[model samples]
Target: MFLLQVDEEIQIKLLMPKDATALTTVLCANQEHLKTWLPWAVEIPSVSTYEKEIIPSWLQKFADNNGFEAGIFYKNKLVGMAGLHYIDWRNKTTELGY
Candidate 1:
């Protein structure tokens, strides 16, 4: 897994299938707030969606060297997610999404 340590209380890493439940819970709790910024957040997804679809797709993206979606952890708890939508190798750029 890709991991990055931002500080004592913050960490970021590629999310695995096992993290589905925790991610689902965090999204559920923050759905209303997230909806304002993320159109897809208008409806919270099920843990199964994360496990079977989202996370798998993200892993594939990483494997293909395109980009990645990762979990944001604070104080050992999952708080949010971040990602690079895609990488433009020729342009040497990527779009950050959170």
Candidate 2:
């Protein structure tokens, strides 16, 4: 479930495909913002890449009964992403790599 919360600052509760468009908007606009040192930075921010790869990766983790992909919001704006990657469902915890 994709959810957004607002308080002192916006806090994204979950991530979903619907949030992709907005997140990409922020990522693309700020592409160069993290390019200098972030080697994994995309040459160009594309929704297809986010959809085709990211979504599937998240689904796979979930199908395996673990982890999730989520976005980060700041003051109601899509700012970044955060989520559990490989989770230990038995322990009620997951590996979050953002």
The whole-model lDDT of each prediction reads: 0.94, 0.70
Error of 1 at 64 (Å): 0.8
The TM-scores of all predictions, comma-separated, are 0.92, 0.62
Winning candidate number (lDDT): 1
Candidate 2: stretches off by over 4 Å: 2-9, 88-96
**Residue by residue across 1-98, what tens digits does model 1's lDDT show?**
79999999999999999999999899888888989998999988889999999999999999999999999999989998899989999999999999
Model 1 ranges off by over 4 Å: none
Clashing pairs in 1: none
Estimate the lDDT of model 1. 0.94
**Tens digits of per-residue lDDT for model 2 on 1-98?**
54656568978666565666786777778778767756667575468767677766776765666776777778767777787767765778766666
